[model samples]
Target: MKLYHSVDTRSLRCVWLLEELGVSYDLDVVPFPPRVKAPEFLAVNPLGTLPYLVDGDTKMSESVAILEYLLNRYDGGELRLTPDEADYGSWLNWMHFGEASLANIQATILRYTLFLPKPQRLPVVGEDLSVFLQERLKVLDAGLQGKTYLCGERFTAADISVGYALLLSSLFGYQKYFTPAITVYFDRLQSRAAYQAARAKS
Candidate 1:
């Protein structure tokens, strides 16, 4: 199996999964272009995004899908989070919340920082997004209350999927609403040796 990776991007999630899974895979690092428009890259995915994966016959385009694929295929090599995990119901809920809430946070950040020109950038929406992210974090903070990992005691693939987005917020220079538990959780996620390795490569 092989994973195509990129540094300072969501591909770190895939690399983090690969490291956690302890699977031997080669990485092909592709530099992000200033303007992401290329026929060859677009052929891989219409969105032309990073963190793409290929395992012999399988091709995965999203980080969450890739994380789940790694978990099911490798028997939870490191982080055993499966949608059908022993804690399936809750895991599934976190996964859905992660996708929906994080998507809004990411899209809003991009529109202000990169997607829009100086004159076109809307600070109002960015401020609105800041409020939205805070509101969403409260729910996450509550879900994480009295828990070590998202799914109780053991670390799982869900952590990698969601944790990667938190890392994104940090990389993007946001440091406003990190609570004590969230801080602890992020520290735990970062403390994993696999996460360290992934961070080095990323």
Candidate 2:
């Protein structure tokens, strides 16, 4: 297996999963945000996105899908809640929520507030996204009120997915709005050995 990664990107989740699985793979670190300009990286993934994975003849991108494939193919389903599990539905909901809902707002906030040039940056738009993200985070906060992880007692890939968004939000200075419950949750996620290992590799 080979993972094309860049520091502090969504690739963090994939690398963390790989470490958790104890799978040996080559980590190909590249410059951030402009993988398209690198000819070698472009050959591996035409779209030139980070977290590109290759296993023999199969190739995958998108951190969430890659994680799903890895857990199913190699983890004996240990990293997921089976359909019969009590938190299965909640797990699926939160997994997609992390990316589809929360991540969209995070990217918008990054673009408007930090990544865009000064003249192009718009704090007003960024504030709107921040508000939207805070509202969405409330749903997660309520779900995590008395739980150890996103679903229930066990830690699964769902936590990794949502946790990354929370981490990114903190980096964007949105942690002040993080509910006390979620603040504790994010800290717990960061304290994991796998998270620390993956971050060190990045």
Best lDDT among the predictions, by candidate number = 2
Question: Candidate 1: TM-score?
Answer: 0.87
lDDT of 1: 0.75
lDDT of 2 by residue, 1-202 (tens): 9999887788888998888888889998888774544767777788888789898987998988888888887872667877887777988888788887787689888898888889999999987877788889888888898799986778889888898888788877778888888988999999999999998985
Q: lDDT per residue, candidate 1, 28-51, as tens digits?
A: 776674125344666666677776
Write down the TM-score of every candidate.
Answer: 0.87, 0.92
Specify the poorest-scoring 10-residue window by lDDT in model 2. 33-42
Question: Which sections of candidate 2 miss by over 4 Å?
Answer: 36-39
Kindly report which residue pairs in candidate 1 clash with one another. 81-157
What is the lDDT for 179 in model 2? 85
| lDDT measured at residue 177 in model 1 versus the true structure, 0 to 100 | 79
Q: What is the clash tally of candidate 2?
A: 0
